[model samples]
Target: MSESLLRVVPTVPDWVPAQDAADAAALVVSAMCPGAGELVACRYAEVTFIDQGANFEAVGCPVCTAPLDGDWWQERMDDAYATRFATLDTVTPCCSATVSLNDLEYHWPAAFARFELQVRNPGRGWLSPDEAAQVSTVLGSTVRQVFSHY
Candidate 1:
């Protein structure tokens, strides 16, 4: 079976409470986008690496936009799985510039430990900036949105 999720996670990942996440998620449903009513059925959850699946692939360098090699991608996935803080420094093959792995984008929704608010089957769209900002405000920390499938 395939499922789609709209996840709101605190950027710090360590300071969010499940109750706050739940409340923020409810606010997202009421104040966000058009299809956000779908979020009403969702709940709060803790995020983990296992949520990544084999879809855990890294993208290009955030600076030069050079695609990562297979070995580099594997190394990134390994680090993500093994470390609590998944940031890493690697040289880009194209520009030879050093970049933080956190700076690079990902092909899939990477897991964030601590807390996340998950909206299952949130119809067919993403959250607006205002909605995200509201969640961030409620959580008392910066937050990010992640879309995932399983």
Candidate 2:
């Protein structure tokens, strides 16, 4: 089974009613991706904190585009779970550029949420910003995309 997923999650601004979130998720699945029916399976999931485990395997410094080393990886991952909007400061190994951990791109296997509208097996698929805005309009909250694999 393919473990890959492309998820849509609202940045939990405050406590959203469960019914509203579910309704918005259904609408997002139906309206966001026309080909989702053929290319992916959509579902709503209740996110558990334990499931916050790392989904992405590789991370690169956004400034220098250098792959982060083990030390940086360990430290960042540790912080990610401990804090909201986790960030770290370190020098890029490739170019010695000072940057924050938030300035990194995580590749496959990255985890991005505690609650999600999951699109399974979305091969090279993405939800556009306009689509996310549509979801936001419906949910009355900001929505963002997160990619991952199991």
Give the clashing pairs for model 1.
none
Q: By how many angstroms RMSD does model 1 differ from the true structure?
A: 4.3
What is the C-alpha lDDT profile of model 2 across 22-120, one tens digit per residue?
A: 675666666655545333323324322213225646778777677887676776557644655333455677788876554456664233334556666
State the TM-score for model 2.
0.56
Q: Which stretches of candidate 1 lie over 4 Å from their true place?
A: 13-58, 86-91, 96-98, 108-111
Give one digit per residue, the lDDT tens place, for model 1 in 52-83.
44455667766777777868766765775566
Prediction 2 global C-alpha lDDT = 0.56
